[model samples]
Target: MQKFLSNKKLIFELFQFNQNFNFARNIYLNVFNKYQKESSIMKEQIKNFYLLLIILSLIALFLISCDNKNKTGTEGRTLSYYAGNWWGKASGETAEENILTINGDSSITLKIGDEIIIPSTSVTRVSDTNYIASYYNSTVNVSTKFTFNFSSDTQGKLIMEITQGSTSQSSTIDITKK
Candidate 1:
């Protein structure tokens, strides 16, 4: 009976919630319930914020990877113009190094060496800026399709490949300008 006395300060402070109280205990239960619901909603939104950030980050990485296909040149650098030393390595049935030297005369020198034997070294330009150097006595041929790969840059990897329907040999070479 004495505990049922009104709390004047509580009633005044919660004047707006006066009509929204639990009549049995005279508590502003409606206001508390609404506040708790809003807080939980805010927490859920914060959790989704991180999830959205993760999805956006993954999309950005995928775009960057697809944008760059061949990645053997310096950043923001196109292929070199002419005349430089290029090296490359390749792997298929066997692995080997391609040492190439290009001259201003539109000629090229390529050496495929594996220590024990130097199969062959040849230099011949088929057309303008296009050259074909063969080794292994025509057994393995590295067709270098060169045009806009380099201009005057100093560092790069030479792309060399054995001709299709030619043989069962491949090599990839890493090169630097001399």
Candidate 2:
């Protein structure tokens, strides 16, 4: 066994193994350093992507909140053109007892005397120049129709021609903004 172990090849391979080991070690360390740098760069890129997403999300949220606020304000209002107290006299009876109130809920209650002439009812938008209101009246047992043709607005006064079908009374009601 001793004679076999004393081979000349083995004696020469010891120096070869040491050189190969040192060369392999240096190459492996260089590769590891480059890999570490690439991994760090990839990590930074991922962080940047996350940050961009967060910013975009915040911007979207802000716009959505602003839209919601505008909508809520509009929804809370009854009408943009008709809001406030109006007083007008129907045909030949200039007693100054006609009063109409348009509420914020798009409802109108009209009073012509001590009793309520028109109950609170729904009001719908027709167009920029017209608005029609028709209501069921149980007092006289007939459907009463009211039609209005808007002329224009100056300052806060809204001039509209109101026509009541029950008595065929036509009058002008000047609405004021509150």
Candidate 3:
């Protein structure tokens, strides 16, 4: 009877230890599972953030390309560059006052003192900085060519050469944009 009771006591102690161990193990497993779920959520959030950044970057790039495509002609220059009223004086043998009006349609109306230059004047742009204006005089039946050299977008010099039966004369005008 004494040996049997000692054996029963040992069995009871072993069972108590096993129950404590099982309770601790259950707690550890629950904590681990909760931490794993939190980690997975954090990973998903980071991935979503990166994906949104990439999409925004691509949209910005597309907008920039569209803006560039809408721009026109050599720094987006238009006919307005040459459209204005310029006033100056004619230099050389025939010194006189000159007022030149340039239109948007490449037409130029030049006034030298009280007289307007004859034969409807028109301008032709040869390059970015060079232009030629032709003036036809109906009475004289001769065409005078004026060459313009632009020093800047706002100021330039104009030279006109008139030839009539070997009698040729030239004049220069300093022009400024108004």
Candidate 4:
């Protein structure tokens, strides 16, 4: 009878241990499933973030190309654009018909009415759109300076300053490409 009771006690302990193991297994499965779901959600969020970044990068590239297309030739001014004939009338201090010619070699010729006042001479570049041509006549003790400022690809302004002894006179002319 004692042996039979011992056997029954051993069976009861085994059943209790099996129940406890089952409970622990259920808890482990639940935790694992929860973590799996959270990992899947995190992976989806990372994919979405990368997708958004690619979309924004494409939009930025498109905007930059469009901005470049809207720019005109004035933004990309070159020395060759100034090699042409310009005609205008001096209006400020002196009134006369003038023809200004810019050569391919960055030289200039100025004609006032029927006479060539300044011969072809090398011009000094002040900037991308500005130049100066200067002449001095020692016989008459006179100095002349012509300043050219190009505003666009085909339009410009010329200012002539003439100095004789201590007296100075200035004139302005609006010029157009021919």
Best by lDDT: 4
Name the candidate, 1 or 3, with the larger lDDT value.
3
Model 1 lDDT vs. the true structure?
Answer: 0.51
Candidate 3: stretches off by over 4 Å: 1-72, 75-80, 92-98, 114-121
lDDT of 3 at 142: 68
Predicted candidate 3 versus true structure: per-residue lDDT over 93-175, tens digit per residue? 35434478766665666776444532323656677778787776778776688888888877888898987767888888888
Per-residue error at 148 for model 4, in Å? 3.1
Candidate 1, residues 104-148, lDDT tens digits: the string is: 553455554442222213434333333344433344434433222
User: Which 10 consecutive positions of candidate 3 have the poorest summed lDDT?
Assistant: 113-122
In candidate 1, stretches whose alpha carbon ends up further than 4 angstroms from where it belongs are: 1-27, 74-178
Backbone clashes in model 3, listed as residue pairs: none
Candidates by TM-score, descending order: 4, 3, 2, 1
TM-score of every candidate: 0.33, 0.50, 0.50, 0.54
Candidate 2 residues 48-110, lDDT tens each? 999999999999999988877544343433343565665555446655443676555556666
State the lDDT of candidate 4 residue by residue for 4-121, as single tens digits. 9999998988999999999999999999999999999999999999999999999999999887763566564444568888888756535434477776666666766444445435
C-alpha RMSD of each candidate structure in angstroms: 15.2, 6.4, 6.5, 6.1
lDDT score, residue 91, model 2?
46
TM-score of 3: 0.50
